[model samples]
Target: MNRRESLKDPDDLEFFDRIQKLHLSLDQEFLNQFQRSLPLNEVLIDRWERASRLGFGDQTSIYDSSLVLGNVQVGKSCWIGPFTVLDGSGGLSIGDHCTISAGVHIYSHDNVIQTLSSGRFPIDRNPTTIGRNVYIAPNVVIAKGVNIGDCCVVGVGSFVNKSFDSNKILVGQPAKCIGEVIVTDSSIDFKYF
Candidate 1:
């Protein structure tokens, strides 16, 4: 009757059915646990598989919708969320156990000078580094050459343009250290200023 019902290959229909079922299961699980749904591309592409294909470290998972450019190095057990951008054209390194939230953008180069001077100047390139055990909240942007030290927390929607030492909790637009992170064997504390 319908075109799908009259498909030439039964295997194609079966494959589509399997994908739908997997998507539903994943969606339901996410809804129950995180009160969210999986993105359509995420349903089709396995995050860990994609990360493995990109040569990320063991146990690291990057969402299918995330864009990763050249020379990006991600360490073990990191979670790179959907719609994030990792611009590694100038070299970007993210250390172990980091959580890069959705909509976060880490840049290693910028064309500000070149664009402002109408191509008279070259694009500035620099390395960006994120140390171990860091958490960058949603919609945050880290500019080129900024090094975020270990055990740090970057608040949501902050624009980080400078380097910070370890155990800092950074917030605000030109992100500043508003707190310190104290890590113990079994607990972690944030001491805000």
Candidate 2:
């Protein structure tokens, strides 16, 4: 169904249009206080990243609209892109200088089987860890308990379900080491074969 047609109030539609034109942004302070007030359906374009108060480290940035849950610990100089889900409900820790691209979803719990079983099966919960200088590309889905080492690049649209060593490029579903990453003093390169 079309969103415009679904709205019952004319004023609501007007407000939505006005916000679209104005391109307003919500800062970290506002988000923390009124997180529950934000609508889930609206397309959010938030650019607000603060200090460790919001579960981030020094020089780390996370969109105000992003959904971050649980004991998430992020180190310095990390860039968590917009519309990402950093679900640390179990536990999550990320080291310095990591880049989590837009539309990425990192979770510490899985309820796929348990949801279908109606409490017959228990939900799996685990801790997730990301090492220093890791790069997670757009639209990647990281499952529970996955540990990503330093200088690793997770390619776009990959579904990572397992742990990997450092300096490798992970790609494809259930992600594989399709390449390697080399970092120098001035440049970071990916070698694919």
Candidate 3:
């Protein structure tokens, strides 16, 4: 079947168009408010404890064991694997069609200086942005203020502390460009060194 034939319904076309343009984010102010606010009186009963608690965008799925905190926002078709910790206390944004593998820890706030300095230095707080069609391998640690561009990949066990341009493949303890990413309408492919 041709691409045009697949879209028999106008609503399907509209939904597809929306997904292509999606960008996800949880802003700082919202995160602060959500963190400070008291919990609602209502308690969940008989419902499965899951990422559905958070207001994720269309077609986003998170593993049952994954933990999402504060004001995290995820775009369409995102897959968050098990044992992942997505800390959005500072801010966090994940774009469309991205894959975050199991045991990945993404932090928007760190208390390194504050704890080391006996509360003298403040905790570092910044927004972390992951762009569309990105793939983050398992056990990766992404620090605050990192901006990963579209169609990028972070290798397993890498600690990402800096930003990279679109279509780049990153690896190492402190991730560095290892290759490139190729994105098409139908798929995203990587070329590694």
Candidate 4:
């Protein structure tokens, strides 16, 4: 089909015509600013992290224009990418040597189910635990109370809502374990998929 005809679908890339851009205009400067002080901002990010019983050395890497974190633990040499918001509000714990890419939002915190009937969710929390040597890709949303094991690959834009076993690959919407990484000694050409 032609481009105009293709735009008829709701899932069309031309659907930008229907949606208003929220991030079309945003302060790009705050993207680089680190949250390591309280005297400057109204509330301190480090103090909040400390109060939650975390051991993250450089909290600057963790971005939060507005992030609600709970009791979380972070290990050494963990690279939490910029724009990544780890909310332990549900009581999540992250391990060491993990590479959480940009736009990866991990929220252990949630809204109270009791308030759902009243059209208000005050607060809900569930603990999230991620093991070491994990590679969580960009724009991946680790949902409330997800416990990902070590050495697993969370594909880009995947939503992880359940516990993932170690040494596996997960991808797609509401991601699932597709396969495991295999180390082969075959000498093959690079063009083959």
Best by TM-score: 1
Q: What is the C-alpha lDDT of each candidate?
A: 0.94, 0.83, 0.80, 0.67
Per-residue CA lDDT of model 1 for 94-118, tens digit only, reads 9999999999999999999999999
| Superior by lDDT: candidate 1 or candidate 2 | 1
Q: Which pairs clash in model 4?
A: 70-88, 70-89, 90-108, 90-109, 90-126, 92-128
Return the lDDT, model 3, position 52.
53
Write the residue-wise lDDT of candidate 2 on 1-193 in tens digits: 8876788898999987776554434333346666633443232534333435675777887776578888889898988877899999879898999999989999999898899999899888899999998999999999999999999999999999999999999999989998899889999888987
Find the candidate with the highest lDDT and give its number. Answer: 1
Give the C-alpha miss distance for residue 118 in model 2, angstroms: 1.3
User: Which ranges of candidate 2 are over 4 A from the true structure?
Assistant: 1-51
Better of 2 and 4 by lDDT: 2
Candidate rank order under TM-score: 1, 2, 3, 4
- Is 2 or 3 the stronger prediction by TM-score? 2
- lDDT score for residue 178 of model 1: 97
In candidate 2, list every pair of residues with a backbone clash.
none
RMSD, every candidate, angstroms: 3.8, 6.7, 17.3, 13.4
Residue pairs in clash, model 3: none
Worst 10 residues of 1 by lDDT: 2-11
Q: Model 2 Cα displacement at 108 (Å)?
A: 0.6
Candidate 4, run of 10 with poorest lDDT = 20-29
Q: For candidate 4, write residues 6-75 as lDDT tens digits.
A: 5656666546543323222222322346432322232324433542344575532343343536666677
